[model samples]
Target: MRPSTDHPVDEPGWGPLARYVIAATLARTSDGGAVVAIVLMVNTSGGSGWLAGALGACITAPHLLGPFVARSLDTARDSRTVIAAASLAHGTTLAAAVLLYPHTHPAVTAVLLTISGLFGPLLTGGISSRLPAIAGPSQRRQRRAQGWDVATYGISGTVGPTLVAAVSAWASPATAALTLAAGCYIAAAVIRFLPYAPAPGKTADVPRPLRTLTGILASGPLRRTLYLTVTVAFSVAALPVTAVSSTHTLGVSAAAAGILTAAYGLGNLAGSAGVMIRPSHTEADRLTTHLAATVAATLLLITLTPSFPLAVTAYAAAGIANAYFFAATLAARNEYAPDNARGQIFVWVGALKITAGSAGTAAAGALISTSAALPLLLAVALTIASTLLSLAERRHNRRYNAPCGPASPHTQPENGRPHPTGPTDRIHDCSNRG
Candidate 1:
């Protein structure tokens, strides 16, 4: 069982957590709103969901190159300062897009969005890297904080689209896009007020971000986490595009898309709350099994559902699973990543998640024209593949840990410490630090 919450860190009243939540909410609101706005803008203007998906891909495309940017930030003096700079750049680019989108071609808009995406790592991994510092020194506190962080993503996912839908009803998609830009600026300001803590350890000692990523990938726990992230990304990628397609298929108002999005977000929020309120063992195998099962079940339900309301409910159920999966992976990241390379691990993990999602979204775009249900079917297949992988991982672990057999080098406990037998010594070693 987990220890009691008597640590000073655990009791750090809501003040600091609230500050971080505000920043997270604002940043994610912009992200969430941008997806809705872009989809609405393209779909309303006689563009296929394919074009809208392309724009979405463009926004996440930068994640493919974001590790270098994240590496630079990791080596910087203050991660918060780096975040501020990235937020400014992202917001400015979005503002420019708001102004130029009307007068410019769709290609220009895509370019601006991609430019804005260059800063996505800052909004996601960069900000998340601060949790260790922000949540104080207790592992439990950090775990709880990570749960809250996931909840913020859900909250923003809800609020952002709600804002877009409400504003678009009153005005135009351009105005909704403008509101997203404004939210980014607000987030930037809020983030500035968050306490800044320098990264732990000497800047010069930190490995190159690529090296950091390679090292983390060597860790069995983290490698499993990354694999799970890839699967989650594919499932999530189908969400935004699928929501749009559902709007078309159901003959519903455009605003219904936002409501469906909100249902998923609400489910995410509830899922996060479940973790916070009722602590569990959180074993990787059990969590993986539960997550995969939920993904398969959610997708199948959505695929078979006959009506829009049923679809929304199915998505919400999936959202709960999504939120739980994220919480598990995030907690794993915090627990297993060494202090020095934590930033890089977070960066690459976030980048991988985005890249996978982008691929899924792009694939959905390509297939949506053929049949709206195709993307969901593809997601189910991917989810099953991921489940098989998880089972394989579990089997490998069981065999490797058998008393009569040679212990696997990757079989370290979650604390990231070396076992006495030395089999797990190299797992996330972090220059022999672990």
Candidate 2:
């Protein structure tokens, strides 16, 4: 390993954040593929649905505690240390999973999965927080980097499972391919040694970062962001449930499922492209409108026809809309939130994501077994909730912006709009001032 540098991370262009994004993408890809193989291997061995669900939860449940682990990123005086330490710790978790899972009992498997999952949020928060430090003074460049990051995530997302599936088909036990994935995590860590900055001076009391995060999440605007994201994330959870269907019951190969998953990712690319291709708008009205439309489109996902062609098509469209929704919510939060709370605000989004995944996964698992359509209906209801909150905010803004009338809480001034000064006659004697 290279000697760590104390270089300032923030710069004018792509640097460590860019590298971190790619490394994170590779790790996620390998884990996802390995998980699918593990799940299938267990099922083929005659594990019951309960066992399958347990294993699935094992894979995801540790996310419930992600918020706590993620908050540790806030404690770091140097993000580089956090990044390096957390990345290697994460790599170790994967290694344990790969080496230990095959020979372990199912109960032990669940324990191993939980232990492994603890690393996920830490890595997620560290990388996310580290990125802003890497790209300086320009939202455009940072957004583009994020887009590339997400795209790589999608690409690996598409290819990883298929690779595992292929190897397993040839090798008799796909689950063992996790050994390869474990190695990939180590590779991710090595890549970070290339170059990255140490984090800035202490911004908050290290001991209380998690508590501070809770307060930030309580803000009305942040609440709205999380609520909307939670709903959207749940809607996305349907995609996985549907893909699993294609893999298991519909006679679709794992490769086909992987491809179908990519289609949704492609849709996400379309959604993200909207921000890049179009003239950007910084206004709240435009942002809310885009978010509302995106959520509305999400409701249509449940309505996709059962056919593989149509289902994949619906999923892709959902991804496009959903991506726009996420970007708008995030941009609006960071743009409008209290400057000091910005880090906390962003951190909570990661927490909400993990929370959403946990809830959505368990719910979807139950519903998918009964009726694949069930998860879709639940998502539609969630979309309605997300949209309603968005529209409510719109109405609130309208009320807040309207000219102060008799019933308005804001007092009208001589200028005929609400002002800090009361509606008094001539506060400043302009006539004689000159």
Candidate 3:
């Protein structure tokens, strides 16, 4: 389907979209800040570095359960209630962890943080899955809203750690944790005011996990998009380690890593802003492949540059490509995911990316002592491989005459349901192609 060219004046859902962006940004900031706050809290409390690391892991590991948790959102009679409850639970657990750290065993604190992490996806993928409804069925508006959503990630990444650091420096790490928890509570309250409703009859027959998995596997575009997203996430997750090592090689203090990382985050915000101002007109699948190649090229440039300034520029450029790539991936999911399984697809893909990122971080930590350039090289190779895989899949589909685009006007909607004869239903028709 062609991208919507509807003017802003024609899109009257800005109020709800604004509320969503605000709530999502707050929740995301809490999620990102909590990690730093927890680590600092543990270290400043005379805990071992290993204990701090373990506590941080407790906050991240349960993100793998995102898909199952998101399934509840998909089938819920009212997703807002589920989302609000999850946010409250996440905040309560984080607060508990902070308050009990001095009085409880490290294992006990870890368990509390793990419970907090279990609801983390509701702040991310769960919020994202609702954008379609909130954006009110205009593809252009939805795309713009998505760009705003991407911007929140960039904003939170920069703001969250900085906020934690400032708070920890001024007051204490425990105070920082409490501040982030309060943000979560505010996000939950904002969610309560969002103008959203579940699609009628969409959840009447809850889909089995196996059925959702089958649907994901059957949709070629969705599968390819998820593959690209995971590969890119895995590659990008090594950036922090690589940046630190690269700065050391350039005879800079390890603290220079922060400057380089911040540059990338700023670049990400720029890219997202560009998308919001002018949503891409290109097909999402094609845009995703192009962006992936751009990312690989930028990473390769980083490896070739010996000058620190040039390296920083390369990192920023790579971030721009990554942002655009992520936006395209979101568009692909919107286009190819079955309506009944949309929430699950978003959450499942998010969970897989988190798992891949953890593995990538571990691999980079293991290999960075060998050479600063090694991790970046690995990233370049993985991104290129993912792009090639997507191209190969597209070629095979073409050879088999299995087009992944929207169904033809003459084609009938599945199950004899009366499909809307409008561009809004284009995604539904594309899913039927599977």
Best by lDDT: 3
lDDT string, candidate 1, 94-154, tens digits: 7787678668787998889998888877788778887766676555566678888998887
| Shift in Å, residue 166, candidate 3 | 0.9
Tell me which of candidates 1 and 2 scores higher on TM-score: 1
lDDT (tens digit, per residue) of candidate 3 on 197-223 = 554245656576667767776666767
Model 3: how far is 217 from its true place, Å? 2.1
Query: Relative to the true structure, how large is the alpha-carbon lDDT of every model?
Result: 0.73, 0.57, 0.79
Return whichever of 1 and 3 wins on lDDT: 3
Model 3 lDDT, full chain set = 0.79
Indicate which candidate wins on TM-score.
Answer: 3
lDDT of 3 at 395: 69
Worst 10 residues of 1 by lDDT: 1-10
Q: Number of clashing pairs, model 1?
A: 0
